[model samples]
Target chain A: MARTVIYERVALIGLGLIAGSMGLRMKRDGLAGEVVGTARSAKTRDMAVGLGLCDRVTDTAAEAVQDADLVVLCVPVGAMEDVAREIGPHLKPGATVSDVGSVKRAVAEAIGPHLPDGVDFIPAHPLAGTEHSGPESGFPELFDNRWCLLTPVTDSPDAVERLTRFWRAMGSNVETMDADHHDLVLAVTSHAPHLIAYTMVGVADDLRRVTDSEVIKYSAAGFRDFTRIAASDPVMWRDVFLNNKDATLEILGRFTEELFSLQRAIRKGDGEMLHEYFTRTRAIRRGVIEAGQDTDKPDFGRGTKP
Target chain B: MARTVIYERVALIGLGLIAGSMGLRMKRDGLAGEVVGTARSAKTRDMAVGLGLCDRVTDTAAEAVQDADLVVLCVPVGAMEDVAREIGPHLKPGATVSDVGSVKRAVAEAIGPHLPDGVDFIPAHPLAGTEHSGPESGFPELFDNRWCLLTPVTDSPDAVERLTRFWRAMGSNVETMDADHHDLVLAVTSHAPHLIAYTMVGVADDLRRVTDSEVIKYSAAGFRDFTRIAASDPVMWRDVFLNNKDATLEILGRFTEELFSLQRAIRKGDGEMLHEYFTRTRAIRRGVIEAGQDTDKPDFGRGTKP
Candidate 1:
């Protein structure tokens, strides 16, 4: 199937995994005539060009967005405002400005007022990524079958529709959600879970009794999954925790409360309660598999072959 | 490699994933002759026979162990003592008795006294499994390149050596550790981590705002991995927690303490602290990959292709 060119020029600010993959995917699908990208670091910009992640690697955000019909802010949550400000005046009058930030409400609030009147501020989060970052870490198929959530605070319906088409053309499932609701859902899904994984890994690290070699050697039993998630980009995750504080805290509170109940069950040797709790959680895993969100193969489809 | 047959008339006293896999692999490797199995549920025993998981499916533990050279207790941790007691009188002289239980110290304590004299009690835990269980879920390759830790509390060196060779022939790397230390190492590596995964999945389930469908759909971000670990067999996990209470709780206490600090950091908007913590945890993930315990491929090597 062929995709229409939704944008004459697409500019990606911050050539990391998300933006880099977006560029490659957009180019591969013929969704953009030209993909211009800029990174804060010169090394990243050079690498982006070397990897052919963009049609053109510009020196600055302003240069990249000069004639771009679609400008994506792919920087961390903390840098969204600065990138928006830098590219605001250079954005085409009828351009649709979106972001790939994980936290929607904070990204919208930070970059909302910075955009000019004629442009649209559609805060979006592509619910897809790998632990690896930078331009070389991305591939054209990264977003295929993954959801890209759009939280458009702008009143322009046409802009949202066009941007939704752009994402779909790039091999993503587009869904519109409210900014606050998106944050809460993401807090439930991504932010809080990452924090818990990080916490568990940290606890294992701090345990003096279990040597690091043992933790790493025997990780395949269960702890290895936590390590895979905890290996995500540190700066981006830190910003996510800082920006999505309230919702993350709320989810954590619920998590700790439930954990305490299970802990008490273990202490009192209440096998039935633990059994019931574990049984119920298994249903959600089945749901994920049925929804096609994950593979049903054992161990997340990891091979057992040597 | 053609593995040497280490035992004749081996009895597996539960037709679950571990025992079923062991039976299949032993047959594949030519490591056992006449692999017999028995399950408390007639349905499971029938299924094991139907799947050709064993040479014979006996009705009772006593019947299965008669004239057996090796008997493995593959039931849940809570049932170890009773199963041992039931099979004690029927065991052949100088038979090697071992278990595939997750927690070592507790299994030793429960089944040690029940074993008849002249039998060796060598508790072993194979750090390999999938989310699926039961007689039909066994695969001959499931233990390939995985760790199998043995905690031999008995004084029979020859018996321990024979059991180690048996596990190695089943396609696992064998290592020996003290039972108590084994519990503590696994507490950090497996038990606490599973509890946390279960807690997070339960919290996602309990949330009224985030519907179950949305969670299942967007689980790939992080929660999907938790769901995978949390989807383990309920009865087995329940017994693990109840039997390994002290060590799991100790790890959980340290876990909550670290979680509290991270929560405080998030509350204070301490991005630096979060970044530092996440960065340190990445080293452990790298170690896991380097040790061949897990793959370094993005998203646990899950494909991005649609």
Candidate 2:
């Protein structure tokens, strides 16, 4: 997993779920020569220091990225550009800067112009997470059995290989795709689904006739699933929707059309149509389980056992 | 658990998730003198036999209930009336008859009328299950943290007490409620949530561009939860929806109205409204986890040992 000890120092600006996992894994596998992390909140810096998630914790992005050979931004999508600008002057010459945002194209557009000429901007998106947020919520095994899609701005083979090795050491299977393709795939697989969950949870919340007690008691059935999604960090999801608006809206449009059709099946008492639609989705669930995207045992999101 | 040994023989008339779990617990705790089970399908009978979920798996409803001191009908709400008609003559005088239906009032109305006058009709609904059905889906722990509400029309205190003991032995906390109330509570919490999941999954299934591969690939975002619910045994859910139509329709009407309001929020770019609603639902999720109705873990249907 040392992967040739590529980077001298890896800077992580914003130690939330993804960065925290990266820090823990870097420590566990010695993937980084030195791990430097920073957070806006003093509380988070203290926690990162106490957890030994990094070799250094700093108040500003400049301090975190100074002299680092690789810099990975793990902040909310909305904050990427600002963080990039803050670290632009301090970044090492010929350093590779990447991110773990849900939307890659927007990230590249937002952060690409800020990096110095010699520094490389290689945007990456890791398709993994739990609803929990902040440093303490992350575990070393969070990236295990998950996909880490790299959307490189420039075809820097050396940069790509180095970053790939870094993520591989962190326990993620790596894939390279274009920025827009990454966004489109995410819009279908993650963005639209999250929006729908947020929508459903909002809907259930509006149902005042059903007391909170009743909804809580019977969540085991299905509503709990939506809650799990809606419970996702608000700023992260909000940024994803806003940044990936076009693709998300496209998927949502398709989703609404399909929903209306199903609505008709229910209204028409067409059990056959309903059953047929339901039967088709099972194959997708099976495919996911077989593809190792999901597990047969119910995932409670307590962090997978090592 | 021998708490008066309510019945010498407890005959479970359907060896599926609920009934199989009941048989497992009763045998595990020695709550009944003997545990018997019945299934219409020979394949199911064989599976139940292989699982050792019952001492005997009879094919006939009449033969299954004969000489049984306690008779539990664990079948679809749609089949309860016909099953009652089929097993009425075989029930011993003064023996108790209970069921594990989602809509208890309708079950009481449909099945209670068909029971013999001497047979005590005590309708019960267990608030527990996995998306999986059939005898193989059950485990002794399925009912460990769930509630089993009994709706008894009979004024026989002794009969109600006896059934309570049986459920306690099955690892359930029993709550005695009227049939109509049980239907209303479940409609809000369980049935409506299920319908929404089914509807969402159906919506995803109809999305032509979001290939099945993509859905499976990015299922962790949120869609997978609905897939699990929508993947549930269709016939059982079909029966649930058809039998509990009034309650289902009522809750669904409320849900649709709420959903429309949220859609308007999204369409109008009402971020405050969206944030406010999303924030409130988090409280309900907290309550559900505290109630132990759901695990606080993220991605419930995704992986093992998380």
Top candidate (lDDT) = 1
Put down candidate 2 lDDT per residue, B1-306, tens digits, no spaces.
Answer: 344555899899888888887777677776778788888999998888788878887888898898898899999877899999999878899899999888887789898778888888899988778767788777777777678889998889999998987787777778897777777767766777777666656555555364546556655557666667677777677677666667777776665566556556556666677667667766667766787766665535321221
TM-score of chain B of 1: 0.95
In order, the interface RMSDs are 3.0, 3.0
For model 1, how does the per-residue alpha-carbon lDDT over B1-306 read when each residue is reduced to its tens digit?
A: 766779988999999988988888888778888899999899999898887879888889999999999999999999999998898888888998999999998899999888888888889999888888887888887787888999997798899899988888887899999998899889999999999999999999988355546877777667888888999999999999998999999999999999999999999988889999999998888888988887776435321211
lDDT score, candidate 2, position B98: 91
A182-286: candidate 2 lDDT, tens digit per residue: 787777667776776666566556554555465566555666777877788877876777788777777677666666665565566677776676667666666
Q: What ranges in model 1 sit over 4 Å off?
A: A208-212, A299-306, B209-212, B298-306
Query: CA lDDT of each candidate?
Result: 0.86, 0.77
